[model samples]
Target: MLLFGTAGIPASTKTNGDTVAGLKRIAELGLGGMEIEFVRGVYLKDNMVPPVAYVGKKLGLKLSCHAPYYLNLNHADEVRRRQAGGVLHHAAGTAARAGARTIVFHAGYYLKGSPETVYDAIKAEMEVVLGKLLDEGTEITLRPELAGKISQFGNLAEILKLSRELPGVAPAIDFAHLHASTGRYNSYPEFAEVLNRVGEALGRESLDDLHLHVSGIEYAKTGERRHLNLAESDFRYDELLQALADVKAGGLLICESPNIEEDTLLLQRTYLDLSPRT
Candidate 1:
């Protein structure tokens, strides 16, 4: 089944650092998942991992994580590139310890390099990262997110290609990002085409266990400006939900709206209303 959740702790959560409290609030809200946001840093301490895992398990909440935004595996500077990889490694390791099934990240920017060169750089670094994680017996999927900006390294094709080439990697298909970046993919047919492309590029099984992101986005000629609350923006979320239901897509869908839980519930309710499988 597709699980819906906030990108991080709900704003109404009483304590900021208490992930247990966040998971409990998610359960009370009747949401099915939570993505720990380490966008600023890997803030979840080693000592707290057990309790977070325990609470999430008790509540039957699916868990995932977003690595720091500072990551740039394609950096020209070797030290800086290694630092970015370190951020991903640390975040993934911590999240895995806390029972998160997947970790999402913006892999890198295109910089001045060709897309082919940049993709090669990112793939090499990610291979090393995956090797180390696998050797350590840490089990978690690394997902390169569909980035919203034109300058970013990950588009739908790039993300799908990366997932295809890498054994332990997958694409985190950000529907809002796809719309903002392309100026299209905003309709039911367009959304269905996206799902079809993924299934074609990856496999039918990929559609069955997708990792997705959704929100209302503001964009410019260059690309994404910011995220908006669903009702306040032009995102055709109802159509998108219908498309997801049509495909019977199953996996974790995290809402990144400013009012996270509210928009999450909006999508969940609307999808259930339209979805035969639900």
Candidate 2:
């Protein structure tokens, strides 16, 4: 079940149009899923849930949420670190209300700390958040994304290790971020190794039900700057799609391209063309 979708509402829709309506419109466009961009803040008020959930259920759309990017669980101040947990808690709760199965977030920044120290700090903070979610009976999985920049805490191995150490958590493998972060290793063998490593550390189910973010991204000596449309960027998406098909990865691939729907459809078409027929 290869799921292809856009990061947010399609560009053709009016800005700040009704979210539920926008989702319905995108579903009609034949996209398999939609990711609510809570990158700034979690904006779904309590009153909005019923309508949003109603439309999402009616349209059979798979929903996920990207939590705010302002998180830094490894902050030097304990107060600020606790605030980050609160933000994640709010985002997780809001995502559950919106019928989202996964709540994605950037785990933290390195901030002059050793990777081991930062990982331990992040793990401790996530344990608190996970406990809170369990107490509140929220079923949405918390996903720490692969950060593009080397300075950030999240790397492929770090996120994978965190998921292994924590319950009810997983890695959101942003392929573009992996490409940029590693300075370009997007071949079929490299991609296969990535899936293999995640499966080896986490489990086969993690790969099957993966949550992914994909786009052609711009980067430099450090890492990701911004996302570009597939046509404008140098990402080897065709080979990537083939690798995914070979693995039978069964989850959402949300496109974060500037031209969201167009690139998403391009991905969908490419995957379908590359996948072997039964």
Candidate 3:
């Protein structure tokens, strides 16, 4: 099924910001999953994952993770690479134990070179990261999200190709990033094109269990400015829902809007109410 949930601990969750409490809240709200936000840093303790995993499993909630925000694989400096690698390594183990099948990250930036150069560097870095994680016996999908900004290393093609090339890698296709990156892709047709491309590149199974991000985005000429609540922006989310329904895309849709549960519920309700021709 296409599960809907928030990007972090929901605001309405009681228990003073505990994750298990958040899971219980999600269940109470009739949401199906959540992406544990380690975006600032990977601070999860060694003992924490098992209980989180247990709670999620018991509650029938699917879990996933967002890795730290400071990664940049295209860098020549080994310090940044090492730092990013350690975080990804820690994230894989933590996410796996937390019952998270995928860990999404913004791969890198294109600071000063061709896209080809950036792609190759990032891919090489990912190879090392994946290899280390596998050796450590942490099995989690490493997803390079399509970043927002003309200067970012990841676009749709780059992320998809990375998924196709790497064994344990996938695309975390963020619709907001796509829209912000090019100032288009808000229509139903554009949305379908994206779904079609994902199916074409990674196959039907990937479509059935895709990881995606959706939010109302604010953008400038260069790229994304900030996130907004879905109702407060011109995101054409209704059309996006119709497209998602048409393709029968499943897996988790983590809402990244400012008002997390409100937008998540809005998308969930809209998706459930969609007709193929709507």
Candidate No. with top lDDT: 1
Expressed as tens digits, the lDDT of each residue in 100-177 for candidate 1 is: 989999999999999999999999889989998999999999999999999999999999999999999999999999
Per-candidate TM-scores read: 0.98, 0.97, 0.97
Clashing pairs in 1: none
Off by over 4 Å in 3: none
Stretches of model 2 off by over 4 angstroms after superposition: none
122-175 in candidate 2: lDDT tens per residue?
999999999999998999999999999988889988899889988899999999
lDDT of 3 at 71: 79
